[model samples]
Target: MNMQVWASLFGVVLGGLLSYLAQFTTVRVAGRNEERRQAAQRAEARRAERLELLREFVTIAQEGIRVAEERDQAPDWAAAGTPEWFAAGRSVIDRLWVAERMIQILFPPRLYRLARTYASAVDHVLWRLPDQIAAEGSMWHHLRDPQHEFLEAARTELGAHP
Candidate 1:
């Protein structure tokens, strides 16, 4: 081939190669970006789920505390031993126990331990007799510290710490 023809042929080959490389790189980069976006979405979904579980657990814990307080404050009713009151207290404890198990399965060890401690405290309060509560100056009062600790840990874990 003539010199001019040879140069044109080489130029075409080089341009085609460069174009292919650019397209390849663009596709690879786009693929990576998409993968990263999906990963981030999955992580956000998991965080939202954890937050919801924590909210439920906290609600159950609060209910347990309320039941304990009611039993403690209403000495006459407690002494009369109405089945409904005991039943309510037992139901609260049951729900709290289930919530604690959920936390143990879904949360880290530190958070689970805190949840266990808080649950135990609530259980103690719920099971205490009125006389025992009076002697101890309110079992719910004793539960406050553990509840606060669990809440703080949960907030930190959920990245909503204040």
Candidate 2:
């Protein structure tokens, strides 16, 4: 072949190789960037979910305390087994049940167990409140240590230092 023709062929091959290399590099970099963006979005979503769960758990705990106090102070007409008493009890129990289910679904095993323990303690206290109130005549106080423990565990699980 002529020298000019050989040189032209070389130029064409070099241009094609350079183009391919540039495209490959661009695609690889874009793929990596997209992966990083997706990972960041997932992390944010998880954080939001954890925050929501914490809020829900806190609300449940607060409601449980309120209901216990109300029940303890209720009038004789609203005594245990009455519609008012049962309604108050059901509301607190239902909220606790929902928190328990959420913890089971959203938390790791360790956190789940901690939350479960708190829920169980609250449930036991509520269940026995009527008898305690009847036997002690409005002088009973529910134990709330488990609630504090669960809150601490939940905070730690959500990446808080506490």
- TM-scores, all candidates, are 0.87, 0.82
Q: What is the lDDT of residue 58 in candidate 1?
A: 89
**C-alpha lDDT of candidate 1 relative to the true structure:** 0.86
lDDT of 1 by residue, 8-77 (tens): 9999999999999999999999999999999999999988888888989889988988876776667485
- Candidate 1: stretches off by over 4 Å: 2-5
Runs off by more than 4 Å, candidate 2: 75-81, 130-142
Candidate 2: which pairs clash?
Answer: none
Error of 1 at 150 (Å): 0.9
Q: Give me candidate 1's TM-score against the actual structure.
A: 0.87
Choose the strongest candidate by lDDT: 1
